[model samples]
Structures are given as structure tokens and as C-alpha cells.
Target: MTPQQYHVIALSSLGGAVAAGISDNDLGAISGYSLLSDNATLHAALWYPGSTSAIDLGTLGGVNSAVEWPNHALGEVVGISQTSQIDPLKEQWSCSYPAGSGFLPYTGQECRGFVSRFNRMRQLGTLGGNNSFATGSNIFGEVVGWAETSKRDPTCVAPQVLGFEAVRWGLEGDAHALPPLGQDPASAATAINDVGSVVGISGLCQNAVGALSAEHIVLWKDGIPHQLPTLGGSAWNTPMMLNDEGAVVGFSDRPGDNNGNNFNGHAFLWTSRNGTTDLGTLAGDAVSYAYSINNRNQIVGQSCTPGCASSRAFLYQHGTMYDLNTLLDSSSAGYSLIFANDISDEGTITGLAVSGAGSILAFRLVPNGGWSGSTMGASREGRSLPFRLRAGSFGRIMPNLTH
Candidate 1:
């Protein structure tokens, strides 16, 4: 029998060849990145994969853009980009090779659309408002996010002022708010799965008591909103990510479990098959929060140790939880695992690592015996160091992994 090999794909500061940005200025090394691959080539930004390298998927004139590689859909990347120099807000951009790439402007906008072989990024306008911000997209090109409205309350914040509403942008550019849960205020969809389900927080804008009015974890499916049952105590509940199978993961507060002020939160996984199950914390830990989950049902998040002296990244799979820091290079010091934002279908984890200087670097963890590379020393002045992996080694890393 042959042993399976895994590769950890991560991007850290090789010293100082800082990740480049729109102004040609260095914007810290890779703190995070999403893999964008076609049938032949795998494209990803160096943390903030900008418009310069790769194919120059231009922005909306902002400093950076975001990319999400759908597990079911290969060879395409969906993310928000700056479209016009006049108003540098986020417009959509799809990157494909040799396709003469460009921007996806909001419908009814004065800007012209660019050409890309992938799905056209049709800007979803706000709810009776002028601006809309997109956060997530599925393989079907269904986009979800919050939009502004014509009715404005001077006291409201940016998203709220726009009447922050979870909206779906599809064949129709006119954004429709996800049905609110009877709360005077509304919600915003943070992540959507291939099954057409959206997850996020729904709550009131403000309360006279100086506390958040009401916040609930919500799931929107078939155009209807269903509030996922909370863990008990709560002034708020937020769903950060959801998998295609409708398995929603987030943090919630349970009453009487801990002090009311910081309602002790436990990372939870909710599925139609199983209501809401708690993914327990690391040994001797009081609070834990799951930030992202992959299709394999593997969960990733952070947990605070007793006394909160340190918080460590954790991976929960097959009913088992392991600390991520223990799996990394032990010699590395002052390294704090912040948040595990996203996980690739192949088990590649991407997140930020805070160093002693407060510098945050992005990293990818490949399974052992998967990616083979020697660590090269940093360059003079501690700028950049080059560590190379075999060109085609990525596929071998996840040969048997499921999406």
C-alpha cells in the first residue's frame, strides 16, 4: 500500500519583496490569497493578486480587489474590482487567459464592459440606491451582498445608510433584499453556496438601550429567510460561511453559559440533517469560533486558551479537533494564528499570521510529503526570499480530496 502525500501551499514574506499593489507600491507580503485556476493554468494573486502580474484584471480604481474560486467551477475567479477612476468603488472582474479581460460595471452605469471568457460580471445595483457592494459569488454567477437605498437616515452607517439588505444579483441587475425576519432593520449575505443558500447576520440598526437591537444568524434559500436557532444567549449571531450542502458555520452566544456581557461563544455547525451541533473548543478553552468550512465537512477557526493569553487556529474534522499551530514549524516564534478565512476544496488553508512586529503574512498549509521545497534565506535588507515548488505539484497535493 502506498502512503498518501499532501502539500501545504502558503505565501509568506520571503523577507521583503513585499506584495505589490495598484500604485506599484509594496502593500505588505501575501497575507491572504485565493486560487484561480483554469483547466490548464492555476492563477492566484500574491496575497492581493493585483492587476499588474498574471493578466492585469483591472480594478474599480481602489487599492485592492477580492477573488473567490468556486470549487465546482474550475478555471474562473469572481471578485470585486475598481472600475472607474472617478468613483473608485468595487465593480466585478472575471479573469481568464487570452480573453482580453476588463471590468463588470453596475448596470445602468456609464462605464463600458470589458471582455472576459468567463461569466460576465453584471453589476447588481443597490436597492433603490446608487451604490452596491458584492461579497460572495457562486459558480452560477449568482452574486450576493448589501446595497444602498434612496431612503437615507443621517444617523445610519455606510452599509445601513444604504439600507443594508442581503440581496441576490443575477439575470436581473436590480437587487432584491432577502426577506427580513420581522425585524425593523435588515441583513446582508456574506457567503453563498452552490445550492443557492445564503448565510449572514440580521439585526436592528441601533437600540435606545445603547445595545445592538437584535442580531440573528439567518439562512436565505429559495428567496425566503430562515433564522437559524441560536445557541441560547445572544445579543447577536453571525454566520460567516456556508458549504454547498447547507452546512452553516458561525459563532453564537448561549445564556447562563457564561457572563452575559461577553456571552460565551461556541463555534457551531448547522445542517438540515442535524439542527445545530457544537464544534467544541481546544482543551481547556472557554470560547471558540469557526470562521470557514470546506466541502469535506472539515472546519477551520480559532479558539482562545484558558485565561486568553493566546488564541490558536484549529481544524475540526471527523469529530476531531487539532490545533493548527502544533502542525506548523515549531521553531517559529511570536507567530499568532489570526483567522482562517477560506479553505480550498483541496484542503489548502489560507489565513493571516501575525508576527512579532505586528506584520501580518498570508500562509497556505499543504499536507506533509506533498509539496517539497527548501527554505531559502531572506535577501539583503530583509526584503524578499525565493522558495520554489514544483510547477505541477499542486494537483498531486489534493489528488484524492473531495470538494
Candidate 2:
């Protein structure tokens, strides 16, 4: 099961390499972040098909903003951005992007979910709290993510003073709390399809971030939360994305995983009909995550070695997992696709690539003569690395959170 030859386009970054995602529509617009000239701030940027110029999606006020999920809405982009208001609670909510990541830190500023359309980015208010994150949005302009409630949940770990819950922002940008699983204190919605179904996590409010905040992976249909099956063990059950057809994909811990203390899980595909199927790591790789799944059933994400210390991008199709690097056109033989971020329904893929000399860059792979695209190639980087898969990336994507 080999993929068709694909030419690569290395999307221009601000000053250095960054992560990116391709839109799920035919336009192929791309959303990613960039290091500004000051090198102290990062802003979300958008790229039109075949264009090298990056349009910086201005921030709300604070220094950082990023688009992690491949938003599916046409003419709309949803993501997390720090606002000028300082968080009274002084918590580093999920909006925080740790240092060393191309983006700047959240700096304890209040953050919010932002919807960008018609050249304006409007902040989505929280549920009576200082922070809210926007991860998914549908064509109807409804957004999904998580927002903090005023409650100082005892369930939260230190520095995480408030309780949070999955949120669905209405067309008018109103935030509505989505119920968590039975007695759960936290939840975060990662993706929403055009049909309005959502997939996310429901669990203990450990840090207002993902780690302890993700327990029971959930699917919301008609606003009712349904617990999605796990890969045996509990903890780390995260639903990163869902397709219009109700297919969900993400990573989860396997049985005997010490309750996710050991992130010993593999990528999984879940459908109402088939339950849950672990996509298993790339041969010896011990960790895998399926970040995006298209209606066509193609899945893309990263697989990492034990401890997730090393990584490689992978494409799973037809019941087989293949390292994306092996399916590239000759022109891109010099680079290794390190993180498979998103795959459009048309089969176009966007992710990060590294050269032999340690240079990293964002890339988009377009199938030969299949649709709109352009290419930039580098000579084989001192001979391709041996064909093998174990672990995968520098960014360490955690679904919607840059953390």
C-alpha cells in the first residue's frame, strides 16, 4: 500500500522552523505560527495555496498565538491567543506555550479562543473565567475547545486554580459549557465536524492543561456526551479529531499502563460501528498518535520511540501503517517528514521536515498532478537515513495545546 508520488512545498517560516496544518477544504490554506522579527513573540500565520508569503494572523494582545488543529471551516480559522488582560488567578492555563517552542510563553495573561474571518479576529469569552481555548470550528462558525469556570476546583493541581469544561462557541461567538462525563471536573473539545459532532477529553482537572485533564475520551452528539472506548488501560485517552462521518482518531494508553503515568499508547481509530482499534506503532515504535482523520479514512500523525524520545510522521491506510518519508517523491528525498499534522480529504499532507544538517521546516505534500500545489526541492541530504521507524518530532504536538 504505497502512496502516490508527492511533491513537497516547504512553507516559509518567520525566522526558523515551526509547526503547521493544512485546511480540510480544497483551497489548501495553511495555518501555522512564526517567530516575529523580535524573536520574542509568535503569531499565527496563514498561507494561500502556491504562495510563499505568510499572512500573520495578528494576536489579541499578549505575545503568543497558535493554530494547532487543522480547522475544517471554510473562510474561518480558530485557535488560541493570549489577550492583554492579566489573569487575576495568575495561572498558566493551557494557553501557555513553553519556552524553546518557536512561540513565546503565555506570560500569565488571560487567553481566549479566537475566530478569524473577514480579516478580523474576535475573542471568544470564557465561562466566567480568565481563559478559554479554541481548537475546532465548523463551517457553520461554531467553535469547540475548553473554557475555565469560576470554581476553584480542588481537583486541580497547583497553579491551576479554576475548574474547566469542554465548550462549544455558538455562531454569535457565545461560549456554552458542554457537560463532562459523570462527575468529571474537566474537559477539552479538540475537533468538530461540519455535522456538529465533537470529540474531546473528560477527566480530572489536574492542571487546566491536558496531562491529567484527559481521562475518558468523549464524543458529543446532539449535545450529549458519550464515553468512547479506550485501548484497554485508562488515562491519556484523547480524541484529537473527528470526521463528518463520525470517525474519531487520537492516542490512548493500553492496558497495564499505570493509568497513563507511562504514555504507553498507540494511535487509535474509533467509529460507532467498529468500536476502537489501536493503529499500533510503526513496528518497534512504542508511542503513536493519530492527529487527523479525513472522511476518506486516511489517518496521519506521529509515532515515537519509547518515552517518545524520537519520532517520525506516519500515514495509516488500508489497515497498514507506513512511514510517510518512504512514500515521498524523489525530489523530497533529502528531508524526513517528522510530524504528520493533518491530511486533507484530497489526500494532501502537511507536517514538519528535517534536513540532515539539522535544519527544520514546514512542508505540504501534494499528489502528482492531482490538484493545486507547487514544489521546492533540496538535494538528497547526504544520503537518505536508513529506512526505519521507531519514534517521531521536535514540537511534540499534544493535540490542541502547544504545551
Maximum-lDDT candidate: 2
**TM-score of every candidate:** 0.63, 0.89
Off by over 4 Å in 1: 1-8, 12-58, 63-124, 153-162, 171-174, 207-214, 256-263, 305-309, 329-336, 354-359, 369-403
**lDDT for residue 53 in candidate 2, whole number 0-100:** 73
Off by over 4 Å in 2: 17-19, 22-24, 97-104, 369-403
How many angstroms is residue 90 displaced in model 1 relative to the true structure, after the best TM-score fit?
A: 18
Report, for all candidates in order, the number of backbone clashes: 25, 9
CA RMSD of each candidate after superposition: 12.2, 5.0
lDDT of each: 0.48, 0.75
What is the C-alpha lDDT profile of model 1 across 1-403, one tens digit per residue? Answer: 1112233333544232221111100122222222233211121243333221333343344333334222222233344443334323222211110121222212222222111223333344667654555555566656676555555444343222334467777734446688658754656676788888888666654310111323677888787888888787655455667887888887776676332356466788898888988887877677776767777787777666432334556677777667665555434544544445566566656554545565444555544543133432121111111221110110001000111
